[model samples]
Target: MAAMWLLRTLLPLAPFARRMRHGMTLGVRAIAIGADRRVLLVRHTYSPGWHLPGGGVDVGETAVEAARRELLEETNTRAIGPLELHGVFFNPPVGGRDHVVCFRVPRFEMGPLPAPTYEIAEVGAFLIDALPETVTPATHRRLQEVASGAAPDDCW
Candidate 1:
C-alpha cells in the first residue's frame, strides 16, 4: 500500500520533472540556405523582421525530420534528402529551453510553393551575397562564416 502510494505520487511528478528539465523549450531559426546559393527567408506575421522558416522540433521528431517538416510547413519547399547538419544554437536571455539546429540543405526543390498558413506570413528566396538586413545577428554571423569558408561542416 505504501509503495503504491509512493509510485502514484512520483508518477505524476515524473512528467513534470521531465518538462522542467527540457524547459518550455522550442526550436526556431532565422534562415536556411540551399544549393545554387539561394537563401530562404520568411516574414513572420507577428514579428517585424524577416527570418528563416523553421519552428519547434516536435516531441519524438529527429532534427532532420524537423527541418524538413518546418521547411514544408512554412514555405512548401521539398527537402529531398542530402540535408547536412550545420550547427546547433542555444537561445538565452529570452525564452525558456530554446534550442535550434540549423542545416545546410543541399538538394531541395522550390516547388509550386504555397504561402504558409501557419505562423509564417510570407516567404521569399534571396541570393546569399545580397541578403536582407533584417536577418538576426546570430544568423548573419553564421552565414558570413559559411561564406568565408570559416565554418566547419559540423558546427556543434
Candidate 2:
C-alpha cells in the first residue's frame, strides 16, 4: 500500500521532469462549432467545470492530429473537415514551458454524445453567449476570443 501511494504521489512529477529534460511540452485543444453555432465543451471527472475537448500531443502526433484525437476521445466527435489553427498560447498555469495549440473545428460528425468516463464526466454543445457558469475561466476566455473575432492571446 505504501508503494502504491508513493507511486501515485510521484507520478505527477514525471511530467515536470520530462519538461525539464525535453525543454518543453505541447498540448492541443479543439473548438468544435456545430451547425447550431454551439461550441462543444467537456466536463471532466478529473477536472472541474466545462472545457473544450483536448489533450497532450503524443511523441509522433502533430497538433492537428492530437486535437482530432482528443475531440473524438472526449466527445465522441470527429473532425471530418479542415481544422484551422486558432493560435498557440503559452499555458503558464500548467507550467511555463507548457504550451497549447488551439484549433477551430468548423465541421465535424459526432457519434452520439459520450457517456461519463474517468477522464470526462460529461460532454455537450453550448452557445457562445450562454456558457455555463461553472465553465473554466481559461475556457471562457478562449471561447470569448473565438466569438468576438478577437485574436488569440499569446498567453493562456
Candidate 3:
C-alpha cells in the first residue's frame, strides 16, 4: 500500500521516466458521461487542454481499475455499473508509443468535484454540444466517436 502511494505521489514525473524507458507504457482514460449526456472533463496543472479524467496504469493494475481509480480521485465519482471499454489507442504525446485504454462510465454517482490541486487545475461536466473551447483535439474526437458510434482511430 505504501509503495502504491509513493507511485501515485510521483506520477507527475512519469513523462520524464517515459523518455528514458525503451518500451511502451499502458495508461487509462475515462469518458464519464452523466444521464443528461454531459461529459466530465478536467484540466491539468501541467497540460494546456481539457481532457478525460484518467492516468497511467500501475504495474499490477488493470486498465479498467486504473480508469476507475483515476475517475474517483480526479472527480470524486464512482461507477454505478460496469464500465465499457471504448477502445485502445496508441498515444505518442511525449514521444514513445504509449497505449491508452479508454473506458466509458455510462452510469455513475457524482460527489463534490475535486478542488484545484498541484496536478489538476479544474474539473467540470459540460454538455456535449457546449464543450469548452480548450478541449484537447483527441478528447473531442473520442467524444464524437462515442456519440456517433463511429469507429475510433488507432491513435489518441
Candidate 4:
C-alpha cells in the first residue's frame, strides 16, 4: 500500500513517461449494475467527473481480472457472474493511445462501502434515468449505448 501511495505521489510524471512509451496501453472500465438496474459510479480524488469504476490493466492481468479488482478496490463489490465485454475504445483523452476494454457486470454482490482512500473520494449506485449531473460525458455515452443497443464504436 505504501508503494502504491509513493507511485501515486509521483503520478504527475506519468505524462512524460507516456510520451516516451512505444506502444498502446490497456485499461479496463466496468459498468457494475445492481439488481435494480442502477449503475455504480465513482469520483476519483485526481479526476473531476464521476466515472465507471476501473483502472489501468496490470502487466499480467486480463481485462476482466482488472475490472473485478478495480470494482472491489473502488466499491467493495464482487461480480457474482460472468463479466460481459461491452466494448473496446481508443481513448485519446489520456495523452496516449489507451485501449480501454469496457465490461459490464449484470450481477454483483455489494459489501459495505469502502472507507475513503487516497484514490477514490465517493462511490454510489445511480439509476440510469437519474444520473448525477457531474457524470463524465464518456460515461453517459457508454450508458446510452448500453440502453439503446447501439453498435459500440471505437471512440470513447
Please write out the lDDT profile of model 3 over residues 1-156, one tens digit for every residue: 999999998998898786668667888999988879899999999989999999999988988889999999998999777899999998887555789899999889999988999999999999987899999999999999998999999999
Q: Choose the strongest candidate by lDDT.
A: 3
TM-score of 3: 0.85
Once fitted onto the true fold, the runs of candidate 4 whose alpha carbons sit more than 4 angstroms away are 1-20
Between 2 and 3, whose lDDT is larger? 3
Write the residue-wise lDDT of candidate 2 on 38-154 in tens digits. 989999888889998999999899999999999999999989878999999998877568898999998899899988988888998898888999999888888999889998888
What TM-score against the true fold does each predicted structure earn?
0.78, 0.85, 0.85, 0.84
lDDT, model 4, position 5: 94
lDDT tens per residue, model 4, 1-156: 999999998899888786678567888999887768799999999999999999999988899999999999999999888999999998997765788899989889899988789999999889987899999999999998898899888888
Clashing pairs in 1: 30-52
What's the number of clashes in each of the models? 1, 0, 0, 0
Q: Model 2 Cα displacement at 54 (Å)?
A: 0.2
Assess each prediction's global lDDT (C-alpha) against the native: 0.72, 0.89, 0.91, 0.90
Clashes of 3: 0
How does model 4 score by TM-score? 0.84
Q: How many angstroms is residue 44 displaced in model 3 relative to the true structure, after the best TM-score fit? A: 0.3
